[model samples]
Target: MSLTHLPSLHRPASHGAGVRHKAQSMLHWGLSQGLPNVVVKMAARKGDLQGLLTQAGSGDEIWEVIDQVRAQGPLVKGRVTFITADHAVVSEVLTSKAFRTGNPLDRLGFLATASIRLRPDTMHPLVEPSLLVTEPPDHTRYRKLVTRVFTMRAVEKLRDRAETVARELLDELEGRVDLVEQYCSLLPVTLISQILGIPTSERRNVLAMGSDIAASLDFGLSWPEYRDVDAGLRRFDAWQEAHIETLRKNPGDDLLSQLVHVQDEDGTLDMAELKATAGLVLAAGFETTVNLLGNGIKLLHDNPEELSKLQQDPALWPNAVEEVLRIDPPVLLTARFAPEPTTLEGQYISAGLQVVVLLAGANRDPHVFEDPTRFDVTRANARDHLSFSAGRHHCLGAALARMEGEVGLKSFFDRYPDVTLLPGAQRRPTRILRGWRTLPAQV
Candidate 1:
């Protein structure tokens, strides 16, 4: 349906009376481990000018678990508290102006709690904690260097190689193969390794280790799990440091070498910044694209007509990719720190108090996205989705991701025009990134 014809959240449900009632609100849920947490409701539920969202206190695992508990509720009309900003907050958070203000991620605490939930650590225990999770100056310095190498110019050059990677992976698929494991997961990792000059032999080991570290942030890990993740980080860092050392003496064409050797007259990146940038690019490039391809394919499975349209005219692949990212983004919500006591949505977020912006919720805000829930490929603003985030923290690898998705999807349909989802396509267990750890489908 056209966005204008799409139903609003408040529109009476097509179902029988009483079926349209919203889900439970101001949820009070608890974690099995310890304390209890209460979710504050957001004014976005009511489409207020100021986006007011309720957040559970970060007192302990209780809050983290509470968010996890809330994540389980219906994706639509989930019980919510005003602590987190709702759709009322999308324009501010996702607009380019937000980033130009400088250090938007840290300034707003975009989704710190979510980050904490993913990996509850006082310090950044993970290697190269995303610029999304870091403060500016701290984030900006490194981000600048990474962008230079990962720019559209550079990423476009890798298109053919990415296609080869996709093709080679698809050729190896067998009956009921996990599209994610065999195709999606493996493709980006290998691609990133190639970009960074890492050998293919180490891709699996690095990816597994990366997964362990990334997984520690979700569902709240135990002390031992945390330690194990930390250990894995050390190993990855040590290995990267060694590799970086090798490049310093004998630089190559890989992305890492570019960062190491590329210099502005003023000197743009430092060693620490270099390592952090390289690590983040490799991890984010691989992980985000992996989820994007898997999710895009899954979306095709869900919307066959859309798939058919794309199959008929691969040109739609670009728009289809945008629609997919918007509708089913890999990263859902992000937490930002309030740099100062700011008033938004008629609510005061005190300085240092963390504010998490629900991108998933904001993307579905009827005001910005006409019929925010209904999936529409031709929607003029479908690309406006916060999947890449906006402002200073907009995804650095977005261009690369887009090119990869466009090429990956186009190549897939060209190769197997009749491809269809198997009876079941696995979904990633966590809510942070929406994807399949395993997708068993046949062409």
Candidate 2:
């Protein structure tokens, strides 16, 4: 659609002062700009997004601001505007209800028609192929095949495997460790190998190849960088092909074999659908999890008090992880396109225009939340955050990601009681994947 609007993260999450500050900020923005698709410029003269967020909502009270945007985001219209990632329209599309979210899309477009341009100029090859880029029926059907191998029951069966990888990563953390490299990288890589039945021995090769594609997200390796992109894809496809071929010859007790057996009333899955399922699961299951783990840890370190509280009471860490997801979700934007012409907040919309939703913003809306800015883990509504997104395409691996985070964080704090950030490597700069390339951690 030519149009406007999106989903929510409305909340009233505070006691008093925080709420007032957020309310005032929301009122100011409402009066000034009246909410539209604004681009948030962070690299500013003065702390940038940090300053803006502090002004409108206490990190604890961002929810209310998020709520206001959800209730009234249609009026906004800018190719790019400035706002925190956790604002109103942003969060609404995340955490499962995004498709139904109004004002965002009303014409037959990418989201409405499910014709994801797996070849968008902005989308990387690996990224475009994932289930996130598809819509219902296809997405649901393909995901069901992969789900057969990635069930909660199966993931629970993977706890030992997960912890084993976590512990190995911890063991590698000596005097200092690139927390992202050591832990975040390990679990997902190991999980990919385990799931694909790609043999632990070949994991390093597979991961090394995928890492280039993953790094492309932060570094931008698109059509312009087709050579590097194609090279990485070629390498991965070769390895995957060899592995898949081998699995077909001698199947084992892993995801590939299980998927091979997956069938419903329609008999076995088609080749492309099966590949799509495996490909999305393997890549997303690994890449996104690593980003989530890294981002979650970096967030805790960014807020020392929160980290300290988490360390002191491990029970609080789970909620803290949820808050981290809300505060700085790994995948910040999920796209949609209108199926038909529709109007939103006085704006006329036509079919075929793509509208992207910012999950981070919805988590910080003001109307629903009292103080939508502060990062209080104990806050009752912390779990309501939309990092996993909403609607049919909600993250299928959410439960798995949560379990991994809870275990990873708890295991981490138990070992390094006095964890602190040093001069670590910088994060990859990307609007899509929100995380660091490296974050130094010292005991």
Candidate 3:
């Protein structure tokens, strides 16, 4: 189908006047976030797992909450959702047909639901048409088309390029640097940009947009914060539309260009699906790897013995990436909803109820991994982490992220074996997506 023949894309309505915009923002914050925050905080005071998760700021803090959840049982009831930290239960929820991806506000009562429905122009990665929340047969179709473009062989082709970029990035480093900014973020963004055929000149803008849009995943965003996130999404959507048009005229060998032309018996993707898939690929393509690289660097630096082992036996680099993911994952948690009444691990879940799976906690389940808290590069089951999630909704860029982590971390450590992590490293202040905001290191 011709690009013009496809369905018209839905763009978010322009921001209203100052007073109106402020009022809308306040309404959105109160119903969609403010009220929910109040409830979760109340639960947190009572030592509830769901509330503790919202309050968790660091890896240590989150793990403490996870331990409390685990102690409760396989499935624990929370104020708004069902919470699970057990590895078996988490795995089941992610893979089962009984559960499906859901919005956080689904169970936040009538006001929250009505608030979302009132905003028809809302756009975010978690919204439908984006593969993150899309269900089959649409999801099945989208995944098939996207997978064809991101095949293992396609990712492997970028390996040599990734290594080259890592080497250049490291070579340019001098005494002190914020590795998160200078190295970790650059490596993956550059690779993902190339994958999407984004021009070098536009990459910095794209990175900034992705960073802002990422706030959509977090809950309880303040009025200004939500406004900024909405603006970023709109900017990205506009740019993506223009870029798709450009590719239609002058297609290249990039995965995105391939996606533009990909077809099957179901025909082709409409403009909305195209934008959603492409936008997701661009954002998710780099976000996880950026975190993995930052987290891996800190994890290895703290665990000198593991670093020494990797230096002694280079073959362990792959498993070292897995170990980092298990011990300090990029994504802390994800939620699944019961489309209908369902039983999981003998716990009956009412229809429309949400299940928040603590992936970081599940990765460290004592039943699944021995000494779950310890960082072991050689741990045989390290790859079994739910960091990239699992089952049908598993991260599409897992292989690419793993490749980037292995190549990026190995290259950095191999070059500066005596690298020292300086003080003042700060973790990103996000609860769901975890990583360093600034990781200063001296080589």
Model 3, 1-443: lDDT tens digits are 42212233223456334445455556666777777889988988987778888888554678788888999998999887899999999999999999999674555577855677534254568878889998899899888887864577888989999999999999899999999989999999999999899999998888888888877888877777777887888898889989998988899999888888878888877788889899888766899999999999999999999999999999999999999999999999999998889888787888889999999989999999999989999999999889999989999998899889999999999998899999998888767899998999998
Write one digit per residue (lDDT tens) for candidate 1, span 196-275: 88877888988886776664344334445445655666677677778888888988888788888878655856666666
Per-residue error (Å), model 2, residue 106: 17
Question: What are the models' TM-scores?
Answer: 0.73, 0.72, 0.93
Best prediction by TM-score: 3
**Model 3 lowest lDDT segment of ten:** 2-11
Candidate 1 lands at a TM-score of 0.73
Cα displacement (angstroms), candidate 1, residue 257, comes to 1.4
Clashes of each: 32, 75, 0
Report the lDDT tens digits of candidate 2 across residue range 1-443: 22121112233455554444334334323322222212222322243332232233223233444344344443344332223233444443233322332223223344432212212222333343357666665566666766655578877887887888788778878887788766787788788787778777887787677666653432212333434544565576666666777877889888787767766766775545556566667766776677778877766767778877876888887787787776667765455544565544345545544355556666665655568777777777777777677666667777778778877877776777677879846765443566677888785
lDDT for residue 138 in candidate 1, whole number 0-100: 63
lDDT of model 3, residue 316: 97
